[model samples]
Target: MKAMSKWNKSVALLTALILVLGVFAAGCGGNEESDAIKIGVNYELSGNVATYGTSCKNGIMLAFEEINKNDGVLGKQIEGVVQDNKSQNREARNVAEKLVSEGVVAVIGPATTGNVQAEEPVLTKAKIPLLATAATAPEVTYDEKTKKVRDYVFRVCIIDPDQSQVMANYIFDELKLKTGSILVDKGNDYSVGLGKTFKEYFTAKGGKIVAEEGFVDTDTAFKPQLTSISSKKPDFIYIPAYYNQVGLIIKQARELGVNLPIMGADGWDSPKLVDLATADSLNKCYFTNHYSVEDPAERIQNFVKAYQEKYDSTPDAFAALGYDAGYLMAEAIKQAGSPDPEKIQQAIADIKGFEGVTGKLSYDEKHNPIKEVSIIEMANGKQKLIKKMLPEH
Candidate 1:
């Protein structure tokens, strides 16, 4: 009887061991079947534009979560590895090289055009396709005069000429500003591109550029530029740079007794703009953006809800652009049916009207997206929706 009882105990122990091993094998199978694809993201996560960078990172991560939850793209789980560009061009190059070294199939980011330009050669050499979410400089995908395509580089945002023309038309036809002064950031592709395009279209519409003064992005005090602009006594001041400098310039201009309306491009979409430039200083300010929350698009509403749930705040244009770019690349990859960079690039080149949170995107021959641009006006420290400019395609 003692031997029989001992045998029964041994049998039970064997059964338990087999059950544990079976469970372990099952878990391994689950993970193995869910193999992931790595997509790299480079952004200005910690610098002067940290707010925008953080927002973009959040959006991209949120999209990855959703995609993974849905079994990811093309039977593969989506993994995103993000790097901060530190809002510097050289850092952008480093980040791009690191991402390429990591075996990422395609990359999205380094938001500004300057950063994009700095990383372009590396990405081009690596043969990795880069889809910039918010780099609107005309040189993003081509040399404007030559109309030559920069094959490895593409943009999910509208290019500068489209945005610049829209803003010019809005000011001239909508606001009826026949004369204005351009306070541009010297040698900034973003500023120079927008300024040149606006000047051309504004002048073509019989408008006059009364005063033009160049300021560097790092310049803290703009009182002198404001004083110089004040001498021209133009109807408005157009600043084409990021909000960090734009806000300060506007505040200093106001403090220096320059009470003209301030206008800008999409770079002015930061909530910090309102926070930094106080109500009294930022009165009569307007700028262009990718989308307006108040515009009532279901995609925008969904994205905002998801973002609020995750991060407890609304998403800005940069965030929306990042999300769209990530999803767009995933879609292109699935369409290509392989991780080959050439195939993915070809697929992206043929991307059609994809309804994104930012806007409806369909690339033109120049690799520029044709979409609607939002004109937002700041009144009482809030972004008041003014108008939507549709693409003239």
Candidate 2:
């Protein structure tokens, strides 16, 4: 009886030990999954700029798929935690905080300048590297007031000042247009910044700003502003606003008999713009963009082909920039050989000559991409490449 009791006790102890070990192993497995290298995507997926956010998300996912197929970076599978910011600044800040708390090593986007700016402080405070895909504002990465680049911030797209100068130079030198008028959305940081830069560059190049007018984003009736600007009879009208407002402004301007050539910034590069404005109204319009689908370069063609095959749609500038941003982050992670945020930040700063779908990108001291801007023209509701301008810097 004593021997039998001892045997039973031993059996019970062994079973309990085995159960404890099993529970521990399961916990470790869960930890591994929780510790996977994660990249956060904070984007405006369901708001005013939903198209841009969706395109960027699709491109980033495509890149993530490819990276995982190759065993991901640093032997850990990369995962993305995507959150919609709803195109609101307050929501963007909250999204940023939520992503950091969830242990993301890096963040990819909040496609618009305003959203990016809104989330900048949160990510910077957390020391997480943010690679802006489509936010072109110079201040996205640089502080003009402090004359310093935010260490944790970087962008894959050219800044607004560079884009504005490119457009201004094209109008002043290539088209030889002397007098121009500006229509700006005062409520939008992107519109206001680009409009100011274009005005500065254009006037410095001996071009005259015959008239300047401003409107809020909610104001759909641009006819009054267009009529006022039309009375100036400028050679071209520069509308530095998003496609949502720019499309209406263009259509209304054409309706008001202000048929002069319309020029805009990268904000106008959306398929929805075509839906908003007629082809005849958009005929003589041009805008500065990151990549032109009409580019015949082998790299560009390959990217476009792969994107089309995967997404079953044409990739726009935002998509290309998002892809580039993903690849850039992967490269930084690989170079760092660890998912540590500081190491990834250093690796990104040291990146040079990184070939991206948009262009060959390298970050300058200010964390802005050193890339060329493509001038795209609207021809029969399609964006056609007209010229590529390299920054003088």
Candidate 3:
């Protein structure tokens, strides 16, 4: 009887041990599954700015592929959760919320300033770092009223003030233009902000703004505004709007015999612009951009080659900015050595002299990238690099 009782006790002990081991193995498997780090991408994938968002998404995916090929950041594979905001403000905010709810470590883009602004409050409250790819409004990172940089917002592109001023200086000094007319999209924060800065700097540099006109994003008739500005006889017409409206404005202006050279900001970097306006209509037009494929630098050349090989198309400024933002986020995560948002944010702020496809980028106190601006001209229906403008202080 004693032997049987002892045998029963031994079997019971062995069964308990097996159960414990099974639980431990299951826990290990769960941890391994959790090792896949998720990053969120919010862009206007199917709306008015679909072209810009598609290019950005392509660049971001390429960067992720390269990172995964090299074992990823912090020994974990990156899984991107992409959401289409439809180029609507409310949709952008909703997408941001959904990404946060899904446990993303960081958010990458919304592409436009308005969308970025729409989603900023949500991200700020949640303490998630937002790395904007192409949103360049000055107020995106800096708050004038508070006189402080927003702690959680950062951008990979030059702000409107810098980009607008670059074009302003180029028109004033390089092109030797004295007077200009402004055509602004009143509904767009990007256009209005760029227009305001260009006017401020252009006039400060002894250039005259002979006429100013405004149009809504829905307005198809720019002929009346062009007629008024053309009568002013300014040396150039500054259209600080997106390519969609700017293309129409340029075509209509040409039809009205307004032949002065037209200048714009980075919003003009799209192939659709050529389709909307004739190649002849875009002649002598220039815009400030982030990168030019014509650049002879080895880094630029390699990126262009790889992009062309992968996408079978040349990358534009939006693609360069998206690539830069993706790599920047990965570098920050690697430096942090963890998926903690606060740690990643600090790591991003500390980055300096990081070589990017666009340029060597360093974050300023305002979390804005310190980089050069590329001025591109539409020559023979192709974008040609005209000059590189370095930041002044």
272-336: candidate 1 lDDT, tens digit per residue: 88777887787798988888877777778888888889988888888888888878988899999
Model 3: per-residue Cα lDDT over 13-55, one tens digit each: 9999998997797567547768777889999999998978988
lDDT of each: 0.85, 0.90, 0.89
What TM-score does model 2 achieve against the real structure? 0.84
Candidate 1: which stretches are off by over 4 Å? 1-34, 46-51, 84-98, 143-147, 216-233, 248-259, 391-393
Rank order (by lDDT, best first): 2, 3, 1
Mark the 10 consecutive residues where model 3 has the least summed lDDT.
25-34
Supply candidate 2's per-residue lDDT for 267: 82
Clashes in model 1: which pairs? Answer: none
Model 1 CA lDDT for position 359 = 78
- TM-scores, one per candidate: 0.81, 0.84, 0.84
Candidate 1 TM-score, true structure as reference: 0.81
Better of 1 and 3 by TM-score: 3
The local lDDT score (0 to 100) that residue 217 gets in candidate 1 is 68
Candidate 2 C-alpha lDDT tens digits along 45-134: 998889889999998988888899998988888888789999899999999998898788999999988899999999999999998888
